[model samples]
Target: MSQHARLPLTLDQLWQFSLQYYSAREIKEACLHLQNHFHGNVNLLLMLKWLDEAKLTFAPQDWSKITQSLGNIESLLRDYRELRRKLKVHVSDSLYKETLHFELQLEKQQQTALVNCINSLTLTDCEHPHLVEQYCLQLGAERLVRIFIQPVSSQSHNL
Candidate 1:
């Protein structure tokens, strides 16, 4: 074997290889899996995007809070999924339609809130802890919006 082939990859090496060794779709799937495991699906994606957009990065303190927020979102999604499944069988057609309508409306509201939250982020907020609180609230709100919009099946469509 070549010397390179015998070498164990470091985290940076593995990250680079993983990005190269698979197609973009495969890399995305792996990212989703790891994000879901570490931060739950909602916050991880949001945090990653938010960081990218703001040209900022997360400190350990911020990451811990974001993970906690994502956990809340995961629970909410689970409940909504269960409710949707139950509605399919137990509810009347009219009632089901109404429930779906409400859910869609709720989804829209969440989306708006998320957008507002993203809007709230500014470079100035980085300096103050109180501003960070407001920034996080907006970020959390936006994260839910992203979750509602990006189902696993539909994600590729956006790309």
Candidate 2:
């Protein structure tokens, strides 16, 4: 645990944080890069960011539970994402937009499940960089960790 107190966050708070964070072009690109190249789950990465921002840290077992809860939804989201990508070039603009919309819905469902899983776990006030590294390393995308932890001012944004 660290000297700073941990903050409790609700699902709405996490969702808002995700929306704001994802609005940044650099953050969006980095997350998509992780998802595309390293098979990372963007919702999980956003959860990690939410935890970091809240000054909360979970144990490995807790993380395992969170990931397990997302298993089914993750598969569905991946399938939809792949379909959306495939449709981008081959389908009409409206059709591609519909696929993208459904994919976003699936992503929201995953985030909801994640927050529920997190609510049931014990968390502490600890440094987050190590935790972030542990997750990114597991994905074999350790080098991209900097993009997540970098200062917001250092990143370019559209919003």
Specify the highest-TM-score model's number: 2
Per-residue lDDT over 96-126 for candidate 2, one digit per residue giving the tens place of the 0 to 100 score: 8888778778888888888788777777776
lDDT of each: 0.40, 0.75
- lDDT winner: 2
lDDT of 1: 0.40
Worst 10 residues of 2 by lDDT: 150-159
Superposed model 2: Cα runs more than 4 Å off: 1-8, 127-129, 151-159
Provide C-alpha RMSD values for all models, in order. Answer: 15.4, 3.8
Model 1 stretches astray by more than 4 angstroms: 1-39, 70-74, 89-101, 104-159
Compared with the true structure, what per-residue lDDT tens digits does model 1 show for residues 8-106? 223232233323323356445544444344333422343343333233433445445544434444556547756886878888899888877775454
For each candidate, give its TM-score against the true structure. Answer: 0.35, 0.84
